[model samples]
Target: MTHLPEPPAAPAAGQARIDDQAAKLLAAVEEAMRTPTSYRDDSPLPDYGPTPPVQQPGAPAMSQQATDVGRAAMFCGLATVPPGLIAIGILVASEHADPTVIGMICAAPAALAVPILAIARLLRSAKPEPEVHQHFHGNVTQTTTHSRTSGVWAKNINQK
Candidate 1:
C-alpha cells in the first residue's frame, strides 16, 4: 500500500503567534480568577445638626371644647331619655294628664341623639399625625467580566 505523505509542519513564526495568544488568554483567565469582583461599601452618612421638621397635614380644624360640648349633649340626650319615659309613665299613672304630652316628651331625647353623635364624629375627624422618608445608593461588579476599569487592569500590565 502507498504511504500517506507527511502532513506539512507548522512554521515556527505561526507556532510562536499561537503560543503568544494562548499565554494572553491564560493570563486574562488567571486575572479574572485571582481578583474577586463586586466589592462595595454602603454606609450611612451623618445628618447635619437637627434635621428640619417634617412637614405635616394641617391641624385638626375642629376644637376640643366643641367636642366636649358635643359629648355633653350626647350624655344629656342619653340621660334624659330614661327620665323622660319615667315621667311620662308617672303622669299617665296619675290618671289626670294627657297621653299626648307624655308622648311628645318621650320623643325629644331620641331626636336629640342623632345630632349629638354626628357632632362628636365630626370633631374626632379633625386631628393630625406624623410622616417619614428613606433613600439608598451603591456600586456593584460581577466575577465573569475582566473589565479594564476594575482591578483586573493591574494583571494585564504585570503580564506585559
Candidate 2:
C-alpha cells in the first residue's frame, strides 16, 4: 500500500479571499447585533406611564378568622379536657354524691351550653349572610440562563 501523507493540505492559502469575506461578514453581523440599526428600533420604549396596580388573589379557604376560630377551638379543647377528666375522678370519689345528682352536676354545663349554642346558631342563620367565593388559578413556568462573566474569567482555565 502507498504511504499516507504526513501533513494535511490546508485550503487557507487557496481560499484566502473567501475566508477574509466570511470574517468580514461575521464581524459586521456581530457589530450589528451588538448595536442593531437596520430594520430594528433600538430606542427606549415610549413611557406608557406607571403600570396599573395588579390585584393579587389570595386563597379563599385560608382566612384569618378561620385560623383564629380553629386556634380558639384548639385552646378550648386543651383547656377543658384535663379539668373535666379530673372532675370525673372527684365525682367518683365523693361518698356523699348521689348517683342521680352526680349526672345532673356533670351535665349542667353542657345543658346550659347546648341551648346557648342553638340560639346563637339560629340568630346567625337568621341574618341574610353574604356568600363570598373567590378562585385563583395559574400555571407558571420560568427559565433563566446566566453567564458568570467575572467568576469564569477569574477561574484558572488550566485547572481540572
Candidate 3:
C-alpha cells in the first residue's frame, strides 16, 4: 500500500476573526446607504444676489366679445351657401318657378340674412358689460379687474 501525507487543517480561529470583521464592514456599509448625511453639516446656502428684470414684447390683444362676433360672422358666411342650396333644391323639386328665378329668390334671402345676422351679432357684442372691481388689503397691494362678457351671445368664444 502507498502512504499519503495528511493535509494541514485550516486556521479556524483566524478565519472566524476575518469573517466577523467582514460581516461588521458589510453591516456598516448597509447602514450608511440606508441613511445618507450631507458632507457639509451646519452650513448655510450660498446666495447669487438680486436678478435683473427681463423685458418682454407686448402681445396683440383682442377682446373676447370681438373675437366671438368675428367668429359668428365667419360661421354665418360659411352657412350662407348650404341654406341657399337647400332652398333652391326645394323650389326646383316643387316646380315653384324657373331655375333662374328660384336661384335668385333663394340666394337673395340667404345673402341678406347672412349680413343682417352678422351685423346683429356685432352690435350685440359691442354692448359692454358692467365692470367688477375687487379690492385686496395686505402687505402686497393687488387690484384685480374683470368684465362679465360671457353668455349666450358669447357662444363662439372658443372658436378662436
Candidate 4:
C-alpha cells in the first residue's frame, strides 16, 4: 500500500502570534473570573408603580352581564333537549298519538325554555332596590335594608 503524504506544518510567525493572543485572552478571562466586577443600576430604572392597563383591539365587546345571561340561556336550552327527546320518544312509542301532536310536544318545551331562562336572568339582574335608611329619635337606632327579588311574587330583605 502507498503511504499517505505528511500533514503540512504550521507557519512559524503567524501561528506564534495567534497562540500568544489566545493565551492573553485566556489569562484575561481567568483574572475576570477570579475577581468579579460589581454592576451599578444606572439611569432610568424600573418604577414600582402600578402598570397601565392594556386594551386589546380584537377582543370581543360583550359585557359580563350579557355573557352570563347568554350562558344561562344556552345551558337551559341544552338541558331541555334531553327531556324533549324523551317526551318525543314516549309519544312516538305510544299506540294512538298523532305525528303532529308528538312533534308539538317535543318542540314546545325546548322552544320555551330558552326565552323563559333569558327572562328570568333579565329579572334577576335588574337594578338593586333603592337603599332604605330609618332613624329613631330617642334611642338613636338606625337600620339599613336591601331588598332581593326571589321569585315572581316573593322578595327576601337583607339587613345591614
Candidate 5:
C-alpha cells in the first residue's frame, strides 16, 4: 500500500495527538474515574477509619447534662412563683411578723434556685457534641413515585 504514506508523520514534539490511540486512552481513563476503580461499594477507602469516642463534661453524658439543665431551669421557675406568692401571703396573713423575715424566706428559695441552675449549666457545658463528616457522592437519587390513580387524586385536590 505504498508504505501507508509514511504514517503521516508523528506529532510535532509535544503536541497532543488527535487520533484513534489518544481517543481510546482518554476514554479508558474517563471510564476508570467514573466507575471508582479503587474500592468497591462494600470495601472501605484508604482513609476510612473508626469514629473517635466522645467525652462529656463533668462525667455527664450529653443527654444527662441536658436533663440536668432542664431540671435546674424548672426549679428556678418554681422558685420565682413560690417567692412571689410567699411575699403576698406574708403581707396579707399577718402584720405581727417582721416583713424582713418573710422577705428572707421568699428570697431564700430564689437564691437556692440560682445555685441549682448554675450547677445545671456547668453540667450542661461538660457534654460533648458529634463531629461532622463530609463526603462527595455523584448522582444522588431522591425520588418518590406514586401510582397514576394516586397522582390523579393529588391533582384533583390541587384543582379544588
Candidate 6:
C-alpha cells in the first residue's frame, strides 16, 4: 500500500480555501457541544389544551312490552348459553352418568329447551322494519336522504 504525498486531512483546493471555513466550523461544533439543548431529560411535556366537552346520550326509548321481550331474548342467548355449557361441562367432567339414565334425561330436556325458548321468544317479539318503495316514470327527478335514525320512521314524498 502507498500513502499520498500530501497529509491525509489536506486535499486539492479547487476553489475557496477551507482553512478559514474549517476553523469557523470547528469552533461552532465545539460551542454546540458545550451548550445545553432546549429539551431537558427530567422535564414533562407541555399541555396542548383541554378537550371539548361531550354530551351524554339519552336513555333508551322503548315500549314496556318491547323492552321486556328484548330483555328475555338477550337473556336466553347471552345469559343461558354460557351457564348451560358450563353446567354440562361440569357434570360430564365429574363422570356422574349413573347406571340410571335420570341425570342425562333431566339435563337433556333443559339444554334442548334453551335454544327452542330463545327462538320462540325472538320470532314472536321480532318487528319488521318500515319500508319505502318508489316507482318513477319518464322525466322524473328524485332526491334521497338517509341518516341515523331510531324507532319507527315513515314518510311519503309527493303523495297525492
lDDT of 6 by residue, 1-160 (tens): 9986864465566654568789889999999999887553555555787755445459757899999999899977886677667766766888865645446755786899899999998997687866979888899977766454446985545533
Per-model clash counts, in order, read 1, 0, 0, 0, 1, 0
Model 3: weakest 10-residue lDDT segment is 151-160
Model 3, position 111, has a per-residue lDDT of 92
> Cα deviation in Å at residue 34, candidate 2?
49
Best by TM-score: 4
Local distance difference test values of all predictions, in order: 0.70, 0.73, 0.74, 0.75, 0.70, 0.73
Query: Residue 54 in model 6: shift from native, Å?
Result: 15
Looking at model 5, residue 137 earns an lDDT score of 89
When summed lDDT is taken over every stretch of 10 residues in candidate 6, the lowest stretch is 37-46
Q: Which segments of model 6 are wrong by more than 4 Å?
A: 1-56, 78-88, 91-107, 110-160
Off by over 4 Å in 3: 1-97, 140-160
Each model's TM-score?
0.27, 0.28, 0.27, 0.29, 0.25, 0.21
Q: CA shift at 70, candidate 5, in angstroms?
A: 19
Candidate 2 displacement at residue 81 in angstroms: 1.7
Candidate 4 residue lDDT tens string, 1-160: 9999965566575566566689999999999899857654455645797765545658577999999999999997899788777776777688648878877876886698899999998997897967866665786665546455656788565645
Question: Which tens-of-lDDT digit does each residue in 40-86 have in candidate 3?
Answer: 34455457866554454485568999889988999989987887788
Best by lDDT: 4
Instruction: Give the C-alpha lDDT of model 4.
Output: 0.75
TM-score of 5: 0.25
